[model samples]
Target chain A: MIHLLAFGMIADVLEHPEKDWPWSADTAMLRAALIKAYPELRDLPFVIAVNMDVAGGEQPIPPGATVALLPPYSGG
Target chain B: MKNIFIQGSIAASFIGESIAKHQSKTDIGAHAIFLGQVRADVIDGQPVSRIDYTAYEDMALQKVHEIREAAFDKYPLTCMHIYHSLGSVGVGEISFFVFVSSAHRAAAFDALREIVDAIKADVPIWGKEIFAEGQGSWKVNQ
Candidate 1:
């Protein structure tokens, strides 16, 4: 399983802090699955982090890798 | 990793103590501080009462570390400290504090501004503005 974490507005939309997906999925596939499950996320801008690093869409998610969906920063 | 996050609104005493700690460094001639306070902004006629901050901790810390290194490389500064709130901070409360010291005044001022701007833009921190009416909205940086 691949662990997924959500933060900020993305968390509010997901209504949950974390979830798990199939480890075979790459970043692109995972994003597609997320957009399918949470359609609102499609229009919102966010980035995917794989193992605590910002990842491109093509990055593969290895088994047990920690992934996160991060929305635009609002910090001062 | 040096923890830069405070759990709630930063206390005035903490800021004072931080300043006091630097008294032993006599070579530091000037210090510049920037404090960010929560404002009660009215949105759709509802006043915001507080802000709840959250972050992707690992990534945020890494980004902060990079920012610190870049600052030190770009500016001639003796030392710098950055503190940001991680939880709820009420209106009129301090949320962010940036302290920079240098041998000269010009470097302090310039480095302080650049560092703060970099943090605001680069860090993976988020703020949710809670309204007086119990509703809240995710804050968007403008």
Candidate 2:
């Protein structure tokens, strides 16, 4: 299982901030699967981070790695 | 990884104490501070009463430290401190604080702005604006 961390509106949609889900081959697949599971996420703009580093492209998701779904940062 | 999250709105006395502690650093000739207050924004006819902030703690610490290091490298700063609210902050309350000190005023001012801008853009934190009637929406940086 891979770890997933969702924040902000995405977390509200997911109903929980953290989860362990079946692993996907790459970030593209992960994004697709998450949107499928939570259709509400399709309309939002966000980025994926793998193990603390923002994913630049469709990269492989190492087993047991933590992935974060980050929305537009509103921090000050 | 230093935790910069404060439990709620930062108190004015806390800010004053922070300044007082720096008095012993005689070499520092200038200090620049930026405080972010929760604005009473009216969105779609509803007035926002407060803001509730949250963060991915592990990532925030890492990101904030990197920001601090970058500021130090680019500016001759004597020291820097950052604190942000983690829970509900009422309108007009201070939710963010950035303090930078240097031997001269220029470095302190420049670094302070850069640091604040970077934190707003790069940190994995979020704020949910709670309307006076109790509805809330996630806020996005402009």
Q: Give the Cα error of residue B35 in candidate 2, in Å.
A: 0.3
lDDT of 2 by residue, A1-76 (tens): 8999999998888998999988998899998999999999999988888898885677889999999999998987
Measured against the true structure, the TM-scores of the candidates, in listed sequence, are 0.95, 0.98
Per-prediction DockQ comes to: 0.87, 0.92
Candidate 2, residue B5: Cα displacement in angstroms equals: 0.5
Displacement of the residue A32 alpha carbon in candidate 1, Å: 0.6
Top DockQ hit: 2
The reply for model 2, stretches above 4 Å from the true place, is none
Error of 2 at B92 (Å): 0.7
Q: Which ten residues in a row have the lowest lDDT in candidate 2 chain A?
A: A52-61
For residues B14-127, could you state the per-residue lDDT of candidate 2 as single tens digits? 999999999999999999999999999999999999999999888989999999999999999999999999999999999999999999999999999999999999899999
Sorted into a CAPRI-style docking class, model 2 comes out as high
Q: Looking at model 1 chain A, which ten-residue stretch has the lowest summed lDDT? A: A53-62
lDDT for model 1: 0.91
